[model samples]
Target: MSAHRMSDPLDRRRFLTAAALRGATVVGTGVIGATALGAVDADAVFAAPLRRPLDPAVPAGAFVEGRITSIDGGVLEVAGSHGDYARVRVTGATSVWKVRPTTAASIETGDGLYARGVPMPDGTVAADAVWVNIVNLHTTIRGIEKTRLHLAHGSHEIVGNLLPATSSASYSGAAPTADLSGLRIGQGAQVLGAWRPSDDSVDIVRVAVGPGAGHRR
Candidate 1:
């Protein structure tokens, strides 16, 4: 028989089982954030610099805000602080963000807003955002719903809300409708766009998921 003979099946099985157990243990011990897709360290995933405070000197093209009464047909129903309400369409470029529970509680119907973005013909505001939350913690996600994805990263988790893959949202290839059936759950993602300051949620602009990622428990 050759020196390089086939390995023992029982040994290999044992080794693999041991490795899997170790991995699970590490994840359970809070070294990694677990999701339906995969695990990432909390320090690495939720780690983002705080958004700068709003400046009065800046122009109106910098930000916008409104209450989210409806999210139907890829459109957002927002009533402005100045008593103006409009339905904004989310095209192939909108990005969605989800925030924490404490952050979501501060906001109520009919609040003042200041946003920055290119204006649409119908008086709807579009652009990225910067604002203050009820708490001092740095935020990443904006508005999370049932199908929204969350990956545990240590004690914390990486969260992502669904949105229309629009030009403004930074998606180019295919558009995932607001319902987000096509997008895989529990994947590594980067959410970009306007955030609701008072509520601590985001109106997403772009979402980037990792390669070959899947969901986990």
Candidate 2:
């Protein structure tokens, strides 16, 4: 999930307290992993989806899908399926959440998201955001590493250890690779994914990061 009132620490705390009363858990315990720090300019990877109206009568209103390119404070930088950027505002009323059954628990970069709300003056959509739309894509593993792994579609740079049961399970038609040696650093990969915000790391079900991973989903 996300801390919506991210602009001010004090405001975040107060807002979170209110959210807790509303039955939303606001602890920075689990859900978000990574710092949202690194530059994500990899625009060539995603393919644009065909546009179908959410409701023809609604004209300017429809659901758009995209990969989360970056998150700075309360701002969510989403590069759309068509390679367009949708800068969304994560306000106190905004929700931070996830999709289910992808993993035990893990959140990482590259998750899919959908937001709903009004568009703002700066070209950013003001999300009356729903956090549950975020999805953890599942893929098979083709490589491994000491810290990071070469997944099947995108790189899963893990920040912690992988369990034997989790690592050994077959996903996307392949079992987990045992050794980390000889894996390329910049190749793309895919894997069964999960997000555990408490640990600040994502768990991989499988990975396919390598030279042959250009197959798009």
Model 1: per-residue Cα lDDT over 19-107, one tens digit each: 33232222112222333234333333333222332333322332456565654433346766677776443322122223321121233
**Which segments of candidate 1 are over 4 A away from where they belong?**
1-62, 100-116, 127-217
Local distance difference test scores for all models: 0.36, 0.43
Top model number, TM-score: 2
Residue-wise C-alpha lDDT for candidate 2, range 126-175, written one tens digit per residue: 44333433334534344456655534434443442354544433323454
- Model 2 clashing-pair count: 33
Model 1 worst lDDT window (10 residues)? 8-17
True-structure lDDT of candidate 2: 0.43
**Every model's TM-score:** 0.26, 0.33
